[model samples]
Target: MSHKNKKISSTPKHTIIKALEKAGGRPKAVTEAADTGSDSEDNSSPENLLTPKDVIAIVTKTIQSELRSIVSELRSEISELGSRTDVVENQLDVVSKHQQTTDTEIADLRAEFSTFKDQLEDLENRNRRNNIWIKNVPESISAEALPDYLEGLFLQMLPDLSKESLNLDRAHRALRPKPNPDQPPRDIIIRFHFFKTKERIMASARNAQSISYSGSHLQLYQDLAQSTLKKRRDLINVTKVLRNHSIKYKWGFPFQLIVSKDGRSHSVRTPEQGLDLLRRLHLIQDSDPSTSASPSQQKTSAPTPSWQKM
Candidate 1:
């Protein structure tokens, strides 16, 4: 066990272990096995000494063996991972196609629903065609007398029209909730028996400028379905622009506004189209705040003489 007799290897095994440790990727088993080899050298006879080349070759052989084992295990795992990736890619492709199909179906359903809604709204408007909305009518009369009261009021506007011609099919306040006594009287909705009579009444009311009942200023409006009202409200700015330019425009059937300019008729169907028409006419500036605003966002314009929310 003399230190002089301990020189079995020229290259110290401890230096090799340190180099492996500094490299930092070798497994702990590599260091442990090197330490065991170093310990065994202490017991070996000097006659059985290893040269520096022999020591280096042993370390290199062990490192290469460990590396080959690691490479083999990694290749197996990488092959399994590649198989899993292929499965996942196939599933994603299937899911992407399914999503596209769902999107197309949803779009079709939405279009169908929109068409149905427009038809329903048109039906509602047609049902209300013969109705006249009378606002600020005094609440003093009984429900049974409401029709008679409305008939008398219309007769004053149309003196030539007989009382029987202005006969109302139905008359009632557009009542909601408990009546607020202090608020201006609830509006009266009167349904004329004949469409021609309703038209005559409306024209006469318009000519009179304003109807007065016992000095209470009465307002008249043609009853419109909520959807039709909304459509008109959306195009309120377009009409405002038209009036500004002395352009003649009238509301067309269903949901269109026909403009007469330069002896040609331009029809607008939607608010978007209304906006485009305004843009083409240079009626509205691109930077105008109303251009970017939605129909509801812009201040709601009322019918001339401000008959709304009836």
Candidate 2:
């Protein structure tokens, strides 16, 4: 009962056999049967009966030999794999460097394309520099009489300008379907032979704030390229913020929003510049999308005048 309660050893079979040879009992009979097998002899001939220690030693040596062979094969495979990994790492580094060079070239091409696009837009705007857009003129005036009508309107705006000097190269309604009488009249685009005349009329009209012809109020705008118009349109939010702050703004040549403060001018060239200016002035709370701040934080921000300042 006491022997049954004792823990069995977890050591190798050789340790158990050694212990049994020292203890003379039923274990001796068991050992005798186990040691007599063909595979049990350690170096001794098969004709002689083998002892328990000899059998256990023979089995241990066989297992150790198998383990050594497996270990040798595994080591060889591991060494080969290490060499292959080094080559792969070198190849990956070359690929990484090539990717970096390709990325740099792509960036250079994109920059050149951007420069080309801006130059093209600038050329388009310069071509129409002497042109002006007159809106809300009544359709009652025929195309033949548009030239005379515009002359009269310009005289009304600038009473001092001589009639002979208002040399309008061309004046006509926009080339589109005429709006219904109830709808507002299509805009009239006029190209003056001289940019100076156009500039004077535009300046006078701006100072007057509004122009009226045949009792109907008219609006004046520059005949800008579609691209220039889009650039201005994209700044609508920025301009809206400036307007809300009571900041007066005006457009400059080559596309600039001019703002004056303390008799000094600051200009905003792009929408991002407008935003940064507003942020710098603390006109709006930080509304970075990366921030945890909610939607209510993004509503307000405020803009600009100068050829170069800011």
Candidate 3:
């Protein structure tokens, strides 16, 4: 036997006997039999005593139980977070779709508005086709006699025109009130019953070079919508520059001014285009004062073109 076996064997037999006696209601004979059995067992047997390996096994099982509980809680939290992330992603998808829809609607509205504006402008221009504007005529006649007076003036300006041949419709001054009492009277706007009659009068006026009544320099021009008139006025400077350079140019339909040079023709719609042509032709030098002025100021310094004299 070794020292460890001796130590285990040193446990008092009386202690074992007392433990058996403590078993509930055991007879004295049964307690003595248990003590005899304990004495007969080999004291060196390892199964009868607590050991380091058994303690380590118990601690390991306790730690494993706690670790399993922690892992389960972490898994549950991760599952909840994943669900919330899915909801956020879905919300983002809906917002993106709504934004796309709004952008599409805005584009559709803009396209419709642009088409409607073009149609309106076309209608307005068509209404003025058979009309003419006469400016700088003295307002000696009353409104009631204005139509007859205009017809008589037209007959005087046109050699072949007569009262029977001219088809008069209506004649009146501009609609707005005079800005100043001393300002010249508003131009007469005349609508003819026949488009041909309006064209014939305009041609005769061009041939006569200058028309005057009551010593006032009267002028005849085709009636145009205010928008078209503004665009043409904006190009007045360009026309003057073109005429000065001997560049053949004419006003085309719907507010286009076409210029022909070196066997090639270019259409201009804005003052910038005309300035570009002038720069290309070397007609406008970089140091010129008109080059730095606004388009309207440039026209003030340049002479009026023959075609636009009226």
Give the TM-scores of the predictions, in the order they appear.
0.72, 0.73, 0.56
Model 3 lDDT tens row, 224-297: 77777787777777787777777788766656788888898888767777777778877897677664547453
Clashing pairs in 2: 258-304, 258-305, 259-304, 259-305, 266-305
Residues 189-261 of candidate 1: C-alpha lDDT, one tens digit per residue: 8888889999898777866866787678988998988888888887887888888888888775676899987
Instruction: Tell me which residue pairs clash in candidate 3.
Output: none
Better of 1 and 3 by lDDT: 1
Which has the greatest TM-score? 2
Ten-residue stretch with the least lDDT total in model 3: 301-310
In angstroms, the error of model 1 at 179 is 4.0
Off by over 4 Å in 2: 1-47, 279-310
Error of 2 at 157 (Å): 0.7
Best by lDDT: 2
Rank by TM-score (best first): 2, 1, 3
lDDT, each prediction:
0.73, 0.73, 0.69
Q: Is candidate 1 or candidate 3 better by TM-score?
A: 1
